[model samples]
Target: MAWNEPGGGNNKGPKDPWGGGDQGPPDLDEALQKLQEKLGGIFGGKSGSGGSGGGGGPAFSAPLLGVLALGAAVVWGLMGFYQIDEQERAVVLRFGKYLETVQPGLQWNPPLVDEVIKVNTTKVRAASFREIMLTQDENIVEVNMSVQYVINDPDKFVLKVRDPEISLQHAAQSALRHVVGDTGMDLVLTEGRAKIASDVQTRLQEYLNLYETGILVSKVNVDDSKPPSQVQAAFDDVIKAREDEERVKNEAQAYANGIVPEARGGAQRQIEEANAYKEQVIANAQGEADRFSKLLAEYRKAPEVTRERLYLDAIQNVYGNTSKVMVDVEGGNNMMYLPLDKLAEQSQQRAVRAPSLDSNTLREITNMVTEQLRRDAAASGSTSRRGGR
Candidate 1:
């Protein structure tokens, strides 16, 4: 017989062990009919028993219901388990309210009873802000800066603010402006930049703390701080002037360094020269005093002899080159009318006397006496001959 026939040989085993026939598995209508029949049997209403007595199949299948329950539990358990990385933290919420914070590791929660929001708490986030702010000197300056922050408290990070990143950016801007407003333009552009950045970080941390944003500001760096580009050249000129002032000061210092020692050396030389001159003058004066004192002692010891020697020296010094002639007017008794010129001539003749000798002494000085007498006789004869002629 064919399988499609109602009493076919294929129907010998009671069709399908699970209850429906092999009509390739039961159709939707057939399955619904079977389900209704099972329900009726379960309630003791009717089954294919052909009696009003309500005897039926087993009420509920224990094995198939247990299988469905076990499958749902497996799926729910998988949903409860989560993994957080080293750089992440998990915020668990119970019934839409924050419950506990979980650190990095494998964690579990009741499936539908709790929810986990994973946050990257250790991740460094950066924010940038730029604005025009007034300086301490009332000058407007535009400043650009970047801030690095990290989530320190995941619970506060998730629940405290609407947008933490945006709030951090605004706080950085406010803190930067506050710091810039208290500083001068020169300081902002130069030495105060680091201080300004530090102050901004501090103030930003305070502000974030106030808002409970749980953002820990690690660093703030000022990228650019200056006047507007339109006046950049003018400010550059001012900077150049300051540099020039410093340059001039350094040059003055160099000049003083070069000149001061040279001046000191010149003054020192002058002092040495004056001291040498003083020493020479004192030495000469002492020598002169010693010579004068010796002469005074000699004069005190032999007054007359010293005077005679001094007089002879004076006369010899005065007339050493002159010839002397002496005339004795008193011997002639001038009543005899003596000739003055003749008498002077005779005295000069006598003053130019020849040498004479006694017998024994003459023998000793004979050669000298003979030469002198010859020269004198020749001179006298020449004068008498000249007078007679």
Candidate 2:
């Protein structure tokens, strides 16, 4: 008989263990119990009906528990050893209290009793801040700046401040605002940028030191500073006007510098010329007075002769400069004419034609003048002697 046929072989026994004849599936509880019994047999035990392994099961041993505990302890102890990088420092704390700082390297701390916080001390860090702030001039500007810093004391960085970086940020912002407030907007935007940055850096450092933040500020730089965008054009116009004003002032100064020296030179020249004229006039006056005094002494010695000689000398000097000579013929009706002007004009024409006067020609002119003067003196003497007769 087939196994599927009911009551075929063991109709007295309960149907089929797998319930193959339209009994749907086996009972979940019975299947699970059978699985448990099979597992127990593999482990050198018998199937059990209660939770206590009532039939038979493997027993727990003290040796196994010791092995597990030893493994856990080893893992826990291993976890206590942590590595610190070359650029890092670790702060050691015991039972939530301060202890000592540890240098960078392989470090060990009691896992549960001690806490370690690793802080980067050798590496530089940076933060940037920006704001639209008011200046001492009551002007508004947008100031952008950055600060570079590093952790100097790991203990203070980790324990002294709750949040070191946050405190630094607040300090930096406050310092920047305070410095900006004390400075003029033009300076903050222009030539005073470096100074403002330095001021901010100093102020921030002071604040950090006061708070014991343990952050060393490396540098503070004002990255960007400008007027508000809405009125930037107006500010640019003002700058241009200021530049022009400066240029004009410089040009005027240069012009004055050039002109002032020339004027001073001219005035100095005038003063020197006046002084020279004064000296010349005074010298000429002194010379003339001395000559007159000598002439007067000679006149006192022989009055008549000296007067005649003086008159002749005056006539000679006057006649030497001109080509015309006028003579008064005493008691004579004839107007005696001497064409000395015509003669002089002819002489000048000859000189222009020849370009040079020969030595003999000059000698002849000199002899003629001497003879004329001699004749005049002789005539005056004869007339005086006749008057005496």
lDDT, each prediction: 0.80, 0.84
lDDT tens readout by residue for model 2, 253-351: 999999999999999999999999999999999999999999999999989999999999998999898866666555433344567889778888998
Question: Candidate 2, after superposition: displacement of residue 94 in Å?
Answer: 2.6
Q: For model 1, what is the alpha-carbon lDDT of residue 146?
A: 90
Model 2 spans with C-alpha error above 4 angstroms? 1-87, 302-309, 316-389
Q: Estimated TM-score per prediction?
A: 0.59, 0.66
- Over the stretch 229-311, how does candidate 1's per-residue lDDT look in tens digits? 88899999999999999999999999999999999999999999999999999999999999779867888999898889779
Stretches of model 1 off by over 4 angstroms after superposition: 1-60, 268-389
